[model samples]
Structure formats: structure tokens, C-alpha cells
Target: MNKHNSSHIYGIRSILEAIIAEQPINKIFLQKGLKGELFMELESAIRKNGISVSYVPIEKLNRLTRNNHQGAVAQISPVKFHVFETLIESVLASEKNPLFLLLDQVSDVRNFGAIIRTAECCGVHGIIIPKNGAAPVTDDTVKTSAGAAFTVPMAKVDHLKDALFYLQSSGIQVVAATEKAEDDIYAVDFNQPSAVIMGSEDKGISPSILNMVDYRAKLPLMGNIGSLNVSVACGVFLYEAVRQRINQI
Candidate 1:
């Protein structure tokens, strides 16, 4: 694809190079029943890095790109993701009260974009997401974020639980936003180094993740609606942190 529409990279060699360079890739499509020395090398690389791949018919590859794909095509992410541990360490070292946002399988591109924008406004140091189920940073996501996707640092991990453990070890408290919590958002002490976890749009935070958080807090809902949209709730949660921090200053 052209630079303007460079969301995908075709051809086996090119895809392999992109992977080696650690480009943020959404998924790779490889022709089924095709094999060669270089192809074997590519497969080894993909497996070593744990990059997502799919085996498909040559016709499927052809449909993905008009170019000579050589039986490979990889969807690329617009934003370059940061290293999870490195990002946390850097933020903790620089900022006295580092704030983070953890997304638990938030699949909607628009919602993810809005959350990034809100996180940026709230001065969140970084955003963490799981590699598998989370939404890829597509052009639509970047547009919806109003370019905030480029501004805020983001990291994708094999698991959110691992990221949570790293954050807690680094002295940042993890907070989960869910209606199941008895404590409201206001009761949580956001003045400390904090990381807020927001769940997927449909199910809310998973029970597994909810149990791991340092604090479980919810928003006060006055209307008939039981809950706010994930992005809206995220905004409320983040701004509460922003509000508390501003008051401290």
C-alpha cells in the first residue's frame, strides 16, 4: 500500500522486515499450502515474536492487495506502541504522581479513541491494552481521537493482568471502574500514583480483573440508565483524577 494508505504491507520479505523492525502489526495473512526457505524463516520469526497470523487461500491474499503479495499480507497499526515495562518505569521516574489507563478488551475503535483522548487530557502517563482482543489503532481510531492517539503513549501486552502486576510493583495503585463496587469514584484517593482500568463495552470489567484491582469504584448514576458508555465513564473516571490533582496544586 501507498504511504497515504499504508495500513497493510504485502509480500513475504517486506512483512518479515516489518516484523523484525517491531512495527505495530494487527495481523498477518499468509497463503495456505505454500512453503519455501524464506517462508520458513518468516514463520519462525512470527512464532518467536508471537505475532498473530492467519493461513488463507491464495485468492484471499489476492483480494487483500492488488500487488504481488507473494502469499503474504499484514495489517499494520497506525501508532507505534511502547514497551510496557519501559513505559511504566520512565513515567514513574519522571512524574511524581503517574496516572495510567488500562483497557480490558475494549473492542470498539471509536470508544478506544475517545478514551485515549480523555487520557491525554487527564495527563495520563500511558495507556495499556491487551494485544489480542483490544481494538487496533486504525485510521478511524486516530481520526476519532482527534490525533490524541499520536500524543499519548500506548503499550500492548500479552495479558492485562501482567501489566497490572507490573504497575502495582512500581507503586502505582490500580483502580477498576465498575458498578459492582460499593465505593464511588470520589472516594478513591487518586492523588497517589494511580492507574484506572475500564472494561469492554458489553460486559464491563471481567470478574478476574475486577478482583485484582487495588480499588473498585463506580460512578453515581441518577438516571434510569444503569451505566454510562465505556468512553463516557472513562472520561468521568479520568477527570476525577484530574480534578483531584488540580486541587492539590
Candidate 2:
């Protein structure tokens, strides 16, 4: 097993140690139908820590380790979380019109990383994603982001709808980018403080979160393909904001 400072643990004893150490586990993978006293103990510890776990085949666990992962492996995050209010307060203190991105179920790690890179290029003050539904910011996500992930402020909130409501109260217009929208994205002015919300490719934004958006705008798609990749679409909106912000200068 590869040594890690963040407590990468395997089957029974390691998992129990991780739980006892109070280390934050990004995720745990357990082989399905693995019956053992240790397995049950690890399962109990995992639940007590509130860590998310997935059941996979023993082969999958073997792939993660040549030695004994005991049908279990855990991935950990490198950074501590940031609070949404702290990010908002920092933006307000800067006296700049806060530009933000709220991601709704964008599970693709590369796409999420690319979006963060674009958001940084466009001068986005912060990026918000639901704590549960978003992509894992693993080593791959950070590598794909090309260090932009470190430079940008990211907040993971428990509920996206409530986060939108908070942003609205803070004077940031929440705009939803969906193909079902009635207006062109270009028609909306980005000079004002704004937050743009993008959804997963499989299903657009969830209705409850969609309803919270102040504006719904769509990009003009003339190609045979009806939609763009979420990362590319995010770049379009972010640069539009950049263009408008530049024009004002």
C-alpha cells in the first residue's frame, strides 16, 4: 500500500484506525458481500464517521491494491473546506461586483476542473457546489485544474437552493443556463453582480434549484449537436462576463 499523510486506509484495522483518528475520508469502497467480523466493525465505524461508501466487487478492490485492501480503500481530500459566508464576505469587502458559479450535479471531474480554470480566468470571485451532488476534488481534479483550483475560492454547501437564496439576498443575480430558457445568454447583462448556475449533462438543473434562479438563459446552438459540454458552456458564460467587465473599464 502507498503511504499517505491523509490516512489512506485498507480493510478492517486501518479503517478502524482512520475512524478513531478522526481523519476526514473523502470516500470508502467496500466489496459487496464481504462477510467477516472485521467487515462489520469497519462498516459500523464508517457509519459513525458519516463517510460516504460504495460497494464494489473484490476485483475492483484488488485493482486499487496488489496487497490486501480487504475489499476496502479510502480516498482523502487535501484541503479543508471553506465556508460560503466567508467567501461572500471577502468578495463584498473587495468592492468588486461579485461574479460566481454554482454547479448543480456536475459530476465529471475534468469538466468541473476545467470550469474552475475558466472561472478563474474570467475573474470569478467564488464557485459554489452542493456538498453531496458535486464531483470529487481528488488528485485528478486538482491536476486537471492546473492550479486554478487552489487559486479560486470553492464552497460546498449542503443545499444548492438555499445557497442560491443566500446569494440572492447578497445581491447576486442567480442565472440558470439551460436549453429550456426563453432568452439568449448574451441578452443578459453580466456587469451586475451575478451567479451563473449550470447543471449536469444527463439531466438539466433540478426543478427546485432551477426555480430559484433569477434568470434563465440559453446559448444559441446551430450545430447538429444540441448541447455543448458543461465545461465549454461554462467558459462561454464566464468569458461573456469577462467581456462585459472589460468593456466597463
Candidate 3:
């Protein structure tokens, strides 16, 4: 077996073993039109685990690795993900006023990394994201996080809406940051158990999510730019929570 990088695993058996081992995998790339018994087994395993997958041309697999990939390559996550329910339950037990951050399909790795860094700095207890649409925790994401990716606990769920309901049922107030909300970030009571949700870069929070949140808040915009970058806005929102909690102490 040829191991190209720590972030990637090549060859069919290697990937299947990784899956069987329950390693944190971001996604798997399989070569189109390539079918074998082993390949079929790998496909079955992937489907059973509900792993994200993409079938691409052999040239794409080649681009991912120069080694003999044997028509398969899997991108490994640099950090292990926490189970959503377990993480929330543990945090609730440990922290009196736990703080959490949720990302609504934030696709940019750099933005996700920066948000993780800021969440760590703000003393957030955990971060939650949807499994598929969110950015994968690749090596680049770790680098961009300045090692904060490892420091902050992150949980991935099959659906953000389900995660939101879980958090709310656990007594955490969910607040969404959006330009459309009338209330500013200052109006929200972040001193209590709170989970702040930041939306994607291009599109803001989804209306379905927006409706479910306990509060929808927006940053006060003074400049010509109507909205801030997702990372920047996330920092501002989290620090506001920090500022409140610090003052309360």
C-alpha cells in the first residue's frame, strides 16, 4: 500500500480499512466506470456509513495522487469530529452557561478555520456544523485555524435543523446572525446558555433555519458594504458574547 499524505489515503483496500476503522473521513473520490468486487464492497461501506462521495474521472483521481491510487482516493479529516448529542450533553454537564457556535453551510475552508479560531478565543464550549454542506476539516483548514481546530470541539450532524432542535430542547437559546433581522446582536442575551449560528458567505441564513431560531440578530452596519464577511461577522458575534459574559462575571 502506498500512503501519499497524512491527509489522504489511496488504493481501495486502504480506504476500506480506514472506513472499517472508523477514521474521520471528509469525503471519498471514486473513479467513474471502474467496478470490481472490492470496489463494490467499498461503495457499500461508504453508503452504510452515509459518507460523502463523488465519482470522478480517472484524471481527477490522478490529480489527487500520483501514486497508484487504484481508482480510489479518500480525503481524511485532520481532526476527529465529536458526536453531536454526546458533545452537547457533556458541555451542558460541565459548563453552567455553555456557549456554542453553529455554521449554516459555511463552505469556505478558510472562513471555517477563522471561525474556529475565533470561537476558541471567545471561550466557546463547542461548534456544530452540518456534515455535507459545511467545509471539511482538511489540512488547509487546520493551518488556517492556527491550530485552534484541534483545540475547539466540533460536532457534525446529518442536518443542521435537527441539531438546532436538539440544542433548543437542551435549554440552549439559538440565535441566528443575519442582515434581515431587526434585532442587533446586542439585544440577544448571550450571557445565558447560547448557540450563535452564522450563515454562508454568499447566501445568509436559510429562511427555514431563521424561523426556527429563538432570536434572529444582525450586526449594525455603518459602512457602504451591507454585510460583513462570514468570519469577520462571526468574530464580532462571538466576542459580543464574550464581552457580555466577562462583564457579568
* Segments of candidate 1 deviating more than 4 angstroms: 1-5, 32-37, 56-60
**lDDT by residue for model 2 (112-178), tens:** 8898888888888889887676787777777788988888888877789889888899888999999
- RMSD per candidate (Å) reads 2.3, 3.1, 1.2
Candidate 3: residue 193 lDDT (0-100)? 95
Clashes of 3: 0
lDDT (C-alpha) at residue 109 in model 2: 86
What's the true lDDT of residue 14 in model 3?
92
In Å, residue 103's CA in model 3 sits off its true spot by: 0.7
TM-score of each: 0.91, 0.84, 0.97
Clashes of each: 0, 0, 0
How high a TM-score does candidate 2 get?
0.84
Instruction: Please list all clashing residue pairs in model 1, or write none if there are none.
Output: none
The order by descending TM-score is 3, 1, 2
Query: Which is the winner by lDDT between candidate 1 and candidate 3?
Result: 3
Q: What residue pairs clash in candidate 3, if any at all?
A: none
lDDT tens digits, residues 1-249, model 1? 222147899888888888888888988899999899999998999988877788999999888889888888889999899999999989888899999999998999999999998888888899999888888898899999999999999998988888989888888899999999999999999989999999999998899888889999989999998989999999999999999999999
